[model samples]
Target chain A: MSNPNMKLLYVVLALAILISILAPFLASSDPDGLESAAEKIIGEERFTELEEAEAAIDSPMPDYSIEGKGKLGEIIAICLGTIGILAISFGLGKIIKA
Target chain B: MHIPDSFMPLSQALIYWAIALPFIFMSLRWARRDMDEMKIPILAALSAGIFAIQALNIPIGMGTSGHMVGAALVAIIFGSPFAGVLVLTLVLLVQGIIFADGGITVMGANILNMGVISGSIGYYGFVALRKRNIDIKASAFIGAWLGLFISSIAAAIEMSLAGTFPLVPGIVAMGTFHFVIGIIGEGLITAIAIGAIAKARPDLVDDKAVEASKEVTL
Candidate 1:
C-alpha cells in the first residue's frame, strides 16, 4: 500500500524550497518585521549602534550573501547547505533504519 | 531575525559550532530508530514551513523582532530526521547569503540552537508529557513554548560562553525576548497545527486527541 501522507509532505516541501530559494530576489528590501520596529523607536542609527569592531574581521565570506569572496564562497554556501542537508538526511536515515 | 558578526563575538560563534557538532552526532542515532522513506516529504515541507515562518520577523519590545523558530513544531510533526536540521540550515544559509540577517561563521550554531534543541529536546519533552494523560492543547503549547524558550536561552549562553555579551545581560535579554516570541508564535502554531491535523488527519497529529495517551507508541 502507498503511504499518502509522505507524498503530501513531499509536494509541500518542494513548494517551500522554491519559495525560500527565491526569497532573496522576491522579498522586499525594506526593513523586515523587527527592523521596522527598531527603526521606529531607535531610528535607523540604533542598528548601527549595535555594530562592533568585531565585524571588522577580514573573513572572505563575511556576510551571508556572496560579497567579497568570488564564486568560491557562493558555491560553497549553496552546495554545502543543500548537499550537507541531503547528506545528513540520507546518512541519518540509514542510521535510524539500523 | 539573524544576528550579525559584529554584535556577536567570534568566541561565541565558535562555541556554537562546538555545541552543534555533538547534537548532529546524536541526531544521527535518533534518526536510525524509525527511518522511514515516507517521512522525507514531511521533513521537507517542515523545512519549508520553517523558512516561510522565519521570514515573518514579527516585532517585539527593545527594538527587536522575533519570528517563529518552529523547532519543536518540526519535531512534533516529523521525528528527528535531518529534515528539521536541514530546514533550519537552509533558512540560516538564505538569511546569511541573501538577507544578511545571520552571519556565515555562526550559521551552524544558529541551526543547533534553533533546530536541534527545539526539535530533539523539545519534541522529546512533548513526547514525555504525552505519555501521561496531558491535554493535547497543553502538550503542544508546552512543547513549542519550552523548545523556543530553552533554545533561545541556550543561544544566549553559547554567546556568553563566546563572550558575545556580558553574561547576565545576554541571558536576561535573549531569554526575555524569546519567552514572549515563543509563547505567541510556538503556542499559536502548535495549537493550530495540532487542531488542523487532528481534524484532517488524526493519525498524523500524534498526540492531539484527548485519548491519544495510549492509542499509539512512536
Candidate 2:
C-alpha cells in the first residue's frame, strides 16, 4: 500500500539512520547529567562501584556496542538495535490492533 | 535519564511499579479503543523514529549530555498520551534488556518517570493550548518542553526519595541542566517533525475528536 506520508516516512528513516549510525561516533562520550551529578555527589570510585555492581545481567550489546568491535561495530550494533526496537514496537501495535 | 539498578531503593521501585502498572493497563485499553489497523504502520514508524532520536545524545556542555526522551513528541503527534506511555515503555524495555542502559529491576521507575509522567504532561499541555485556539505547531513545541521539564523534576524527586541524593539539591541539579537542554531539544525536534507531517500529510496533524476530547481535563 502506498503511504500518504511516504515522503515523510523517508525523511524519518533517513534521519533515524543518520542519528543512530553516524552520530554516535561524534557524540560526546561524557556521562549524562544524572551520572555526572552522581559522580560529583558520591565520589567517582563509589559511583563506578555502583554502576559496576549492576553488571548482573549479560546484555548482548552492553553499553550500546559489541565488545571489542570498536567504532564500526558500535555503529552496526546500534543500527540493528534501533531497527529491532522499531520492529518490536510496530509488531506489538499490530498484534494489539489485530 | 535511565536509572540504574541498585540506585533506586527497593521500596521506591515497588511504589513506582505499582503506580506505573495501572497506566500500562489503561493505555492498553485506550490503544484498543482509539486506534484502528490502518494506523498501526504509521504508529510503528513514528515509534521507530522516536527510538532512534532517543539514542542520539546531544552534548549540552559541562561534560554533560541529554538525549531526547521523545515521550512528549510521541504524545503530541499521536494525540494520545497513552500511546506515548506505550512507546516509551517499549524503548526503555529494549534499552534495558539489550544495551543495559537501564536496569531490569528499576524498569518500572524508569517507565513511570520517562513515560507516564512526561507523556501526560505533554498531552495535557498541548490539549490545553489547543483549546485556547493556539497554533497546533506552537502548542506541540510548548507541550514538549513542559512535559520534559516536569519529567526531569519527577526523576530528581525519585532519586531523592530513594536516598541517593538530597531532595533540594537533586531537584535543582536535574531541573536546571535538563531544563536548559530539554526545552530546546524537545521543542525543536517535535516542532520540526510535526511541521514535516503537517506539510506532507496534514490530515493527521489534528483529529477533530481528539481535539474535542482535549477539553476534558486529566
Candidate 3:
C-alpha cells in the first residue's frame, strides 16, 4: 500500500486531473475573460493583428488536446508524466540532496 | 501555449531535439547531491499552487488571459539543479492534461521552452540580481519577468526555426503577444509568489539560491 500521505497527494492530484480532463466538456465556449476585454477594445481584428497567428504559428492543435488515439493516449500521457516525474525525483534526491 | 506539431518544420524540430539531448545528458551528469522523498510533497504543492494561480485570469486586452507560469518562484524555492525542472514538469503535465494549455505531442518542446528555458534561466537571473543586494522581492520580480520574456523569444525563435510562422511575421507575432504576457501576468505573479515563498517557507530556500549582491575579492 502507498504511504497515507502519498495516497492523499495522489488522490488530490488525480481529482485535479479528472476535473481538468472534463473541463473542455463543461467549460463555456465564450471568449476567454481577457480576450473578451481585448475584443471590446480592439474588436475581433485585434486577435488577428498578430502576424504569426495569421500566418503559420496558428497550429490547428494550438490548444486542442489531441483527443484521438482513444483512451490509450490519455492513459499513456499520465503514465509517462508520472514515470518521468518519478525518475526525475529519484535522480534529484540523489543529486541535489534536497 | 505549447507550439503544436503543425507549428514546427521537421528539420528545426529535430535540431531542437538534438540540442535537448546533450543538454539533458550534461544536466544529469552534473548533478552531485540527493533530495528526500518528502520533498515530493513540496513539489506537488508548488505545482498545484501554480496551477491555481495560473487559473486566475488576469485580464489583458485582446481576448486572452495571460497566465503566470511559476518557473522563477519554483527555482527560488527549490534551488536550480534538482527542484527547478521538476516543478516545471509537473506544471506542464497539469496544463497539458487538464486545461489542454499545450498539446501532448509537442510537450517536449514546451518543457524546453517553459521549464528548461525560463525555470533555469530565471533561477540564475535571480542570483545575479541578488548580488546587488536588491530586495529579494524585486529580484524575483525582475528575474521572473526576464525569464518569461526571454523564453517567449526563445519559443518564437524555435517556432520560426520550425517554420511555425513566416520568418518576419513569426518572431514579431510571438514577441508582441508574449511581451504583454510577461508584463501583465508574469511580472506581478513572480513578485507576489516569491514574496510569499520568502515569508512562508524561508527554510525551504537554499542560501546560495539567489546570487551574491556584489562581486567578491579574491
Candidate 4:
C-alpha cells in the first residue's frame, strides 16, 4: 500500500479502537430495541425468563464486561475483543484468499 | 440483535441454522475463487471496524438504544453480499464465544438474521440502485437502511414464529424502532465510511468499478 493509503487504514483502525473503548462507557444501561419491545409486548416476568434463559452457557466474558474488574476490565475486554475480531478476520481472509 | 439460546425455541433456531449454513459455505467458496489477495487486510480491517461499531450503542429514546451492524457497509465495499455474511459470522462468533452476548444454540438464527439476510439483501439493494444511476452515497444510505429494516422484520417474524410473542405486535415494535435506527444510525455510518474510503483510497472500493462495468453492459 502507498504511504497515504497505509495512513488511512491506520486512521480507520484507530477510530474503531477509540469507539470500542469509549462508546461502551456512554451507552445507556437500558435494554435495546429487541429486549425493550419484548418486554413491552410480553410483560416483564416473561422477559425476565428470556433473560434468565440466556444463561445456557458459561462465557468467559459475559456481556463484554468482565466481572470484578470494573472499568479497567472493560477496557481490557475491548482490547481483547478487538484482537479476537482481527484474528478471525485475518485468519478467514487468508484461508479464503489462499 | 443477538438471540440467546432457548430465546427463540429449539425448532426455530435449528431452522435458521439450516438456512444460514449453505450460504456460509457458498461464501467461503466464493471468497476462495474470486477474492484478490490484496483485499485481505482491507477486509480484516473493515471487519474489525464492524465489530467495534456494533459494540457502540447509540441511545434512541424510550430507554432504548441501537448499534450499527455494518453488514451492508461490508457488502457495498466488498461488492459481495457473501463477504458481509462471512464478516458478520466472525463478529457474531467472537461475541458469542467471548462476550456471551449471543447464545450458542441460536447462533444459526443470529447468523441468518444479521449475516445472510441483511448482507445479501443490502448488497442487492445497493446494486439495484446503482444500476438505476443513483448516486453512490444515496444508494448506500438507502441500501443499508432497507437491509437493516428487512432484517428487523425478519427478526420480528422469527420471534413471533417461536411463539415468544405475537407476530403483528412484534413486527410493529421492532420495525418501528429499527426503522429510525436503520436510517439514522446505519445509513450515516455506511455513508461516512464509504465517503472516507472514496476520498482517501478510491482504489480500495470495488463497488464503483462494478457499477461502471454494469453500466456498460446495460
Model 2 Cα interface RMS deviation (Å): 1.7
**Cα shift from native, residue A53, model 3 (Å):** 15
User: Quick one: best lDDT, which candidate?
Assistant: 4
User: Which tens-of-lDDT digit does each residue in B40-121 have in candidate 4?
Assistant: 7777788778888888878888777888888889888888888888888889988888888888878998898888887877
lDDT of 3 by residue, A25-48 (tens): 443344443233333433556444
Give me candidate 4's TM-score against the actual structure. Answer: 0.94
Write model 3 residue lDDT over B120-217, tens digit each, in one string: 77778877778667888887778787888787778766655654344555556556666777776777777776676567656656546333323242
For candidate 2, lDDT tens digit of each residue in A1-98?
56564455566667787888875677667787788778777779988988888554779988788888898877887788778876886688767878
DockQ: which is higher, 1 or 3? 1
Q: What's each prediction's TM-score? A: 0.68, 0.92, 0.66, 0.94
TM-score of 1: 0.68
Writing each residue's lDDT as its tens digit, candidate 2 over B87-129 gives 8888888888988988787889889888998888887887778
Deviation in angstroms for B26 in model 3?
5.5
Native contact recovery (fnat) for each candidate is: 0.25, 0.58, 0.12, 0.67
lDDT over C-alpha atoms for residue B156 of model 2: 85
> Highest DockQ: which candidate?
4
DockQ, in order, for the candidates? 0.20, 0.64, 0.14, 0.66
lDDT of 4 by residue, A1-98 (tens): 54343454467689878977886687567777788888899999999987987465688988878899997787778768886787787787777676
Q: Spell out the clash pairs found in candidate 2.
A: none
RMSD per prediction, one decimal? 6.3, 2.5, 7.3, 1.9
Off by over 4 Å in 4: A1-8, B208-218
